[model samples]
Target chain A: MSSILKVQGINKHFGGLHALNNVNLDVEQGKVHAIIGPNGAGKSTLLNCFIGRLTPDTGTVDFDGTSLIGLKPHEINQTGVSRVFQTPEIFTELTLLENVMIPALAKRDGAFKPSLWSSMAGETEIRDQAMNALSEVNMGGKAGMTAASLSRGDKRRLELAMALVQNPKLLLLDEPTAGMARADTNATIDLLKTISGKGLTMVIIEHDMHVVFSLAEKISVLAQGTVIVEDLPEKIKGHPKVQEAYLGGAHL
Target chain B: MTVEQSKKDKIMVIGVVLAVLLGPIILNPFGAGYPDLLQKFVIYGIFAIGFNILFGLTGYLSFGHAAFLGVGSYSAVWMFKLLSMNIVPAIILAMVISGLFALLIGFIALRRSGIYFSILTLAFAQMSYNLAYSVLTPITNGETGLQILHGDPRVLDAAVEDGALPVTNLFGLNMNATADVSLLGMDIQFNAGYYICGLIMIVAFYIALRLFRSPFGMMLKAIKTNQNRLNFTGVNSRPYTLTAFVISGIYAGLAGGLLACTDPLAGAERMQWTASGEVVLMTILGGAGTMLGPILGAGVIKYFENIFSAYNESELMDVFSFLPHWLQELVVSVSSLFVGEGWHLTLGVLFMLIVIFLPGGLMEGFNRLVKLARGGYRKDGASASAAGKVTAE
Candidate 1:
């Protein structure tokens, strides 16, 4: 498979602390890839660097063969790379449909026009597209409901729907099932299966072993900012370095 | 999609149209200089509505909006003195100039958020105010204010026609004469200026409504709620916010132009920080993010400022004329403390109370009353529905 994302020699430092040191990652197109590590691992920092939330002191990242260094977060998003925060960063004040519609509207060609006025039904098309996106996660029924009222799992699902609406080329989810209940975690795993079935490229950071094993075709074990092992989940399960770095915390 | 929903929408539209058409007439029945106050209310209401679009919806607190208002007033007055007495051209010029000024200010202020943006706007407004009062005296006419001179040039519509200008009114509507009739023993008279303001306010209101429903508005709200998320979602929030700021500044300019048209004067006081603060109060008191809230807030504030501030001991005595001498005297003496100049004190108290107990402003109180009257099984839920979403952990 062709490489959709390539990270080369990325190093980040916070004063005396080396948060990420010479980390390298490459994601193939249309594959479900998971990154797992201990709490202090640089999983989130790596994700942030990809989305331009934080710039690495030294290194480069390329998305779809385009260099992503020095780009703003929004510019990175515009380049077909989208991320979901650990804590579902959905717009709580807006309706679920509106929450989805916002990203959808941004993706449309004439999103920047000042005087663009559409009829109520035409606006409904935006909502319909949002609903269609939601339907992928089986959340279409909650379209008109306020996003704040949704359960944690539902909010996560809604965030997924919002990301899906953008039709991004690479979706990065940071600890997507971190705070989910056991049932919700399994449901998220199912949702990931559904998403990956569509041949969409995804990079997920998950601590949940059940979820990672259920969805990831390949797993990368990270410790203290650098990748220690990259192998199939079955091989990673038995790797000595992976066990020493992550096995104690894997129950989470 | 439902019949009831469609009917409710129809009612809302009709109610809005009626209010726009007959607001001045219905609000001031006694007419005791109330029409003038009503006009001021509507004009300022339009201004506040525009201001709310930026501050309320976008979570931006601008301290330089009055600069736009002042610029509009100055431009309008200059137009009247140099070109024509007609308000349309003056207002258009005012809006355009204000928008241009906003574009400049927004570019700088939008580089920062929170307190930095506030201070930047304040510094810019203060600079403009000082320039207008001193350095720009040749154009602004200085502290003495700008006025229409008798020998000023007349261009286009200002030209005398058929020995005299053909009795021009707002949009050619007969204002000084209405159906050539009388109502309730008083001649029903309207000024071309009043109609012009009403028409402009209607346009402003419509524009505000369109903006509220637009995708840009949605993005603005998102920016307010979560800037980081919006940035990651591929929206350049700076440009979006700058555009909103410019649009709001134009609205403020239009209001200022209308004021100059009514009074034929533009003064440096219009650009004062206090004036900017007044619009902020109006937006907050009316319900910042709501559509009709700022208008209601402006009406309330202006009513107190103009109508209530004008009431004196004599007016109080006249109101209590039917009462006995001692009671009238007592009433007058007591009421004197709360009238005239005391009106600001009353407003200050009201503003403090609203901010303390009703942070959502008059809209929250009104929504609560509406919920109480509805008396349904979901009454408890309904009251909290319109209140801002309480933070959920």
Candidate 2:
């Protein structure tokens, strides 16, 4: 499979401290690529760069051969890259259905079309897509409920629904299963597995070993701001470089 | 939308149109039956509604909207002075100019949100006020205000019949003309100017309703709720917010133009920062995010400004006539502080009470009442909606 998102020689700094050090990644199409690391390994910082939340000090991030550097977050998002924030950045005051509809509208309408006169409820196609995305995560029944009333797991699901409804070419998830209960985490993994079967590319930053091992087709272990190893999930388990650089701790 | 939701929307539009058409009759019981007072209510209602479109949806609090209103009034009045006495041209020019003005100010002021945005708007409005008061005297006429004079160019007007001040009109329909009808022993005066302003306000309210139900509005609310998420959602909030700001600015302009049509004068005081703050109070006092809240807030505040200020010591004596002489004297002395010249104190107290008891504004108060009437079902949603409004900052 061709690489859909290619990163090379990405470096970032905070004063004297190096946050991301000459990192490189090649995410393939139609696969779940997991980035695993200990805390402060620059996994989130790297994800932020992908979504244009932070600019790398120096390097290139090419999505489908288009450079993503210096683009505003929304501009980057408009280029078919959608992100699920670690903390589930859902619209707290809006309904779940409405929450999902926004990104769908954004995806179809581009950055700004000024769809001022069109009634949002009248966007039947987008609405149906949003509903389908919601029920995909088992949230179709509570579409009318305000998002603020959602539990953390449900908020994460709604956020996932929001990202999915966009039909993005590349999905970046920052800790998709972080803070989820065991049952919720397992359900999310199953949901993600089904999504990956549809031939969508996703890059996930995760701490949960179960989620990582279950869903990731290829694993890239990040340690000390650089990729220590990149290989199939089966090979990644006992790779001595990954074991020494990251997995050397009690985690299997 | 569901059948019930659209049905409610239809009813709401019908209700607003009917209320505006029958404003004089409806306001008669409240002692605001006169055409002039009713004009203020409708005009300011338009102002507040437009203000709410900005402050309500996207959570951008602008303290410089009065500048747009002032610009609209000046544009309309200029149209009258240079072109015609017809309000159609005046109103159109007013909206267009104010929309441009909003685009300029909104472009600059919308750069930083929250308190910084508000302060930037406040500064812009204050600067405009100072300019209109002094530097722009050639156009604005300074403290005396711009007025059409005898022999002044009114190219579209038919040669100023015997130097009588030209009355504002819509295609020769007299704006200042009024007719009185007695209903149930209460006299209600319906002025042509009031009806024109009333019709325009109804249209404005309808547009606001459509905007509220639009996808653009949802995007705006999303920005208000979580802009960070919206950015990642692939929507650029700047243009959306700028559009809302311009639209509301145009609303303020429409209100300003109507104010000019009502009296045929545009003054610098109309652009004062305090005047801008008044729209903020009107929106918050009504319920910033709700459809009908700002109009209701404007109506209540204007009513207090006109009626409460009309009260005097004699009115107090008549109201307290039933009490004993000593008690009446004591009551009048105490009550007098809250009326007449001190009516602002009464308004302030009332405003404080509403904000404290109903942080969601009068809409929340009505929601509570409606919930109470329905045995308090869906109890969580009332507080949920209220919580939505309180997070506007």
Candidate 3:
């Protein structure tokens, strides 16, 4: 498969601490690529660089051959890269349907459209699409509920639905199931598998090994501020370098 | 819009139109049917409505909106000075000039959010007020304000009509010209200026309603809810916020223009922070995010400022005359602080009460009352309580 997202010679620093040191990654098209690391492993920092939340001191990030190094977050998103945030950054005050509708509107209207005179009610197609996205995440029944009133797992699902509504070419998720219970995590894994079956490309940053093992077509183990291993999940499971990186060379 | 949303919008428009049309008759009972006060009601209602478009919808607390209002007034006055006494040219120019001014201010102020945005707007407004008062004295006339004078050049049409100051008019119809009628022992005066202001306010209300139902409005609410999420959703929030700011600024300008239409004066004091604060108070008191809240807030505040503030000790005594002498004396003494020149104290107390008890403003209180009338508190009470917390920021 052709690589859809390419990161080369990426370096980021927060004062004296080097958050990312010459990190290189290539996420192939139509695959679930997971980046797993222990605490303070710079996983989130790397995700931030890709999504324009942080500007790497030196880097080249190319999504579909377009440089995403200097683009704004929204502009980058417009380039067909949508991100599901770590802590489920849904529009909590808005309804679940609205939370999904917002991204759909953004996708249809571009980054900025002065549609002041146009009624949101008339956007039946967009609304249907948003509802479809919500249903895909098992949130269609609670579409009218205010998002803040939703449980933490449902909030994560709603956020995932929000990103999905954008129909992005590449989806970036930061800890998609970071705080979910085991059942919710399993459900999310099933959801991810269902989505991946549609041939969508995703780059997920996760700490959960079960999730990493279950859905990831390819696993990239990150240690300190660099990728220590990049291989299939089965190979990554028994890789000595990754084990040493996680276990600090202690026998397991 | 959906059938239901459109129906609601239609109802709102009709309700506003009726209120504006029958305001004189309706307000007559309250002794606030005078042309001047009615004009103030519609004018400030427009102002508060416009302020809500920004603050209520987008969650951007602009403390410098009065600058646009003042700009609109000055532009309208200048239009009258240079062009003619026609209210059309004045109002149009006022909206355009204030829109441009808002573009400039919004471009700068929208760079920051939260309290910093408020402070930035405040600084810009204060600067405009000072400039209009001092450096721009030649145009603004400083402390005295800008008004049509006898010797001023009026290139369009006649400079003077019958050797007196030319009154502002719409195609020869004088704004100050009033038609008085007595209905059931009550005097009702309908002035040309008040009707024009009222009509414009109806249009403004319609526009505001359209804005609220529009996709643009949803995007703004999203910005208020989670701007970061919006950004990641491929939506540029800055332009949406700036647009909201400019739209509301133009609304303030329209209000200012209406003010000039009724009174034909432009003063630097109109740009003062206190004036800006008044619109904020109106929006919050009425309900920041809800339609009709700001206008209702404006009416209540203006009613108190005009009618309640005029009551003297004698009026107070007359009101409490049914009580015993000692009780009446005590009531009048205590109520004295809330009426006449001290009416602001009453308004302040009311503002405090609303903010403390009903943070969603009067609309939430109204909603709660309706809910109570229907039944008791519902399960969605948590969400109802959570509504104001997000937008209040």
Candidate 4:
């Protein structure tokens, strides 16, 4: 499979500490790739670099043949790279439908549309697409509910719907199951599986082994700001390097 | 955009029009039906409404909006001095000039948000006020203010008949012209200028209502909620906020122009920080995010400043005539601090009470009254639903 996202020789430093050291990763098209690591493993930092939230010390992040090094977050999103934040970053003051519709409207009209005089009522196409995305996440019934009033799980689902409405090619999920209950995590894994069935590539940074093993076709073990093992999920289970990195080489 | 919303907008427009048209009759009962006070009501109503679009919807409290109002007044006065006595060109020039000023201020102020943004705008306004009072004296006419002069060139106006001072007019309809009608032992005066300002205020209100319902308005509220989410959603919110700032500035300018149209003088004191605070007070007191809130707040504040302040010790004694002598003496001594020249003391206390009790302003008070009138309050469901509606803004 062709690589949809290619990160080569990526390095980032915060003050005197090395955050990401010569990191190299490739996410294949239409595949679920999990980046599993311990705390302070630079997983979120790497994700931030990919989404233009941070500028790396030295690196090349290639998404669909375009360099995402200096682009704004909104510009990077426009290139069909959507991110579901670790903490559900939905518009809390807006309705669930409006929360989903904002990204959809941005996609339809662009980063800036002078829609001052134009009414939003005529945008039936965008509304329908947003509604469909909400239904895909099983949140279609509470479309009119205020986002702030939603439960944590429902807010996560609404945020997922918002990302989905953009119809992005590469979805970056940062700990999609972070703080979720077992049943909710399982439901999320099922939702990810259904999304994967539609042939969308995803890069997930997760701490939960069950979620990582269940959803990821390929797994990469990261520790001390570098990848220690890259292999299939089955092979990663028995990897010596991954165990050493996680257990501090004590039980060799 | 929905049928219900459209109907609501229609009703709001009709209601505002009716109110403005009959202000003379409606306000007569409160002894504030005269042209001068009524004109102040509508002018400041426009000012507060414009201020609300930025502060209410976007949650950006600019403490420098009065600078734009002062700019509009100066521009209108200049137009009157150079062009003609007609108010059309003057008002139009005021809006254009203030819009440009807003563009510059907004471009810089929007770079920093929250308290920083407020500080930047306040600084700009203070600078403008000082310049207008001193350095820009040639344009602003300094501390004495810019007023119509006899030796000036009113290019479009005809020669003054019988050497009388030139008066402002709308295509020969004198703005100062008034019709008095005696009704129920009270005299009602309706001036042409008040009606002109009143009409413009209605138009401004309608535009504000449309803006509140528009998608652009939704985007603004989203910015207020979570600007980071909007940026990540692939939408740039700066231009939207700048547009709101300019639109509001234009509204302030229009109000300023209307002030000039009525009085024919532009003062540097209009740009003072206290003037900006008054508009902020009006918006918050009425209801920042509601359509009717700013206008209601403006009316209340203006009525107290004009009508309530006019009451003397004799009037107070007349009001307290029913009470016993000791009670009257005790009440007058305490209440004296809140009326006459100390009316601001009453306003300050009222403002404090409203902020402490009803943070949502008079609109929230009205909503609670309605809820109480309906069937008394339920425990959780009512407030929860109300909170849901608030967040939906």
lDDT of 3 by residue, A13-119 (tens): 89999989999999999999999988898999999998899999998999999999989999999999988888888888887777888899989889999898988
- Give every collision pair in model 2: none
Candidate 1 lDDT by residue in tens digits, B1-393: 223434554565466567756664566454532446656877898899899999877999998899999999999888877776666778889999999999999999999999999999999999999999999999898999988665666575555534532332344453232332355555444545555666777677767766776777788888888887777777778888989999999999999888887777899889989899899999999899987789889988987787678889999999989999999999889878778989888898899999998899998888778767988535433433332132110
lDDT of 4 at B343: 95
lDDT of each: 0.80, 0.90, 0.90, 0.89
For residues A1-252, write the lDDT of model 1, one tens digit per residue. 788999999999989989998988889899889999999899998898998888999998999979999998878888888787888898887777778877887777333435325422346667677878888877776666677788887888788888998888988988788777887778778877887888889999998888889888888888998999988989998888887886664643
* TM-score of chain B in each prediction: 0.86, 0.95, 0.94, 0.94
Over A1-252, each residue of candidate 2 has an lDDT whose tens digit, in order, gives: 899999999999988979999999999999899999889999999999998989999999999888999999999998889899898789998888889989999999988878778897589889889989998888887777789899898999998999999888998988888778889898999999988999989999998878899999999989889888899999988877877775455455
Ranking by TM-score: 2, 3, 4, 1
Q: Which should have the higher TM-score, number 1 or number 2?
A: 2
Give candidate 3's error at residue A2 in angstroms.
1.8
Supply the TM-score for candidate 3.
0.96
Q: After superposition, how far is residue B379 of candidate 2 from its true place, in Å?
A: 2.0
RMSD of each: 4.1, 3.2, 3.2, 2.4
TM-scores of the candidates are 0.90, 0.96, 0.96, 0.96
For every prediction, compared with the true complex, DockQ reads 0.32, 0.52, 0.57, 0.52
lDDT of 2 by residue, B308-382 (tens): 999999899999999999999999999999999999999899899999999999989998888789885676866
Give lDDT for model 3: 0.90
Using DockQ as the measure, name the better of candidate 1 and candidate 4.
Answer: 4
